[model samples]
Target: MSLKRRSFLKGAAGGGAALATAAVVSAPAQARPNKVMPPQAVGLLYDSTLCVGCKACVAGCKEANDLPVDVSTPDALWDTPLDIGPKTFNVIKVYAEGTADTKDQEKNGFAFIKKSCMHCVDPSCVSVCPVTAMTKHPQTGIVEYNADACIGCRYCVASCPFGVPQSEFDTPTPKIMKCEMCKHRQAEGKIPMCAEVCPTGATIFGPIPALTEEINRRKAMKAGEANVFERRVIGSGDTHERPAAKYLDHVYGEKEVAGTQFRHMSAVSFTKLGYPELREQSYSSQSEGIQHSLYQGMIAPVVVLGGLVWAAKRASHIEDEHPEE
Candidate 1:
């Protein structure tokens, strides 16, 4: 029955009421819908069947990005990176089964997969970043990182579904590194270095719509049929003739996490190629929706803070009124 106790009870009730009101106000809320692809979205189409295990794309990526050579070999004579790292933005990973005699076969075959940023339409990195260092270009949909704006939180590294973002932990001033799809080259009317140097047309860069069309074209082809695959960019005169491998029914990144700019088609199952199966809805969309519902207009937090302040002031007044109490 003390004044302090009564005041505490009132404050608690008021805070609860405020929270209830906020929840009621937000009752109609739904998780934010996944973002759509940008109007002029550009991306890459990677065909594992066409890749010849050549590391030309890897070298091109490093050279285009001005990254340091990752020399893992003891001899250090060549730039040999086993995986994508701070110094290496692109890498070719191989998956082999049994004797690996046949390429792109699940049994007794080996397959190559290119690893890099997926450049999601609704990127979790851009969503989770406290700072605006991680951004998705409105027109190009290229997920870009700004070192100056980065506080080295590594939120992007953790939020990425594709595990593309890498943090440079060894350096004093570390940076989050990932492929930006060679936006700098695109600005100059050039394609990404990886696509430019790919001899087999495994990786080609172009607008999303065009890429989709090409993907459809490839998907419609009969297995082992001789075909002409365009190299570098879509509609480019550069091309080569080759036989098509049997492609899987699925096209990766089409709906995973509400779609990504980079599309992958392979004869080997994506799961076997180290791709995680993701939902159509992006994690960011759900997280952001809950956040918005709870903290909409910042009303809930302000009300809670005010209730605490009122309780504290009341306690101070009660102490002054009854010195022994």
Candidate 2:
């Protein structure tokens, strides 16, 4: 390194160290430990094996949420987005292979996948929202967005690993939109709009604990076994008759991305259905630790200013003694 570069690095080393120390020292000592959520957080349990890809959930979601129609083709007036967008909150993506004959089979088969907010237990969108516009409900565990509080920063959209949040680029006063488990409907003891209208009982909603148990029970069953799955919210007083397909012995959201409130059970692999493999260690935990350690409350900053002020004064005194014409 050059001489000036070396000198600057040496000076910054002390400043950085001091800043880190101050931040950590100032952090609240009474920080509470994270609470474990019961199986009761209302969420979606999409069984890919049962889905027929009718797109009823998508249409219902747009109508319930009041989102605009997505016209992919210039000639087409009907809304049919190939993927999720600002106007389309929920979508059903298709995974076709070979001849695409069988349903929920990895080879020479076709499977339909639901795409929307996973509603993560440790949601990065909620953690990174600068204005707290995106927040997680303490009791319900539902992640909701308030457009009035939003500054149109779109940080929630960028931070989400599942790409659930989308910004309204077509409007000047745009807002972020994603799944909220239909908080408004929940207040009336009604289930989410998507689940209420789902014909297949594929997208069932329930508390995390109850849903997990149901998922496990299904996983233990053999293919073609008779099972009655509930549509809309589990125990919302609705049931459907169906046979279980041979699952891949895995649950998609059980452990992915630090576990999501919205769990998924699929006969086909999650990768085939467009779900990205994500690390268990939440990005928020790492980011918060780094920021807290580096700059807590401007304590180190004041010390650095003091040092700079002293250096400038000493240099001025040296210049007076030298008296350069």
Per TM-score, the best of the predicted structures is 1
- C-alpha RMSD values across all candidates: 3.3, 4.2
Task: Give the Cα lDDT of each candidate.
Answer: 0.90, 0.79
User: Model 2, 43: alpha-carbon shift in Å?
Assistant: 1.4
Give per-model TM-scores: 0.88, 0.85
Cα lDDT of model 2 overall? 0.79
Worst 10 residues of 1 by lDDT: 21-30
Name the top lDDT candidate.
1
lDDT of 2 by residue, 78-147 (tens): 8889888888888988999999999888899999998888888777888899999998888788889999
Clashes of 1: 0
**What is the Cα-based TM-score of model 2?**
0.85
RMSD of 2: 4.2
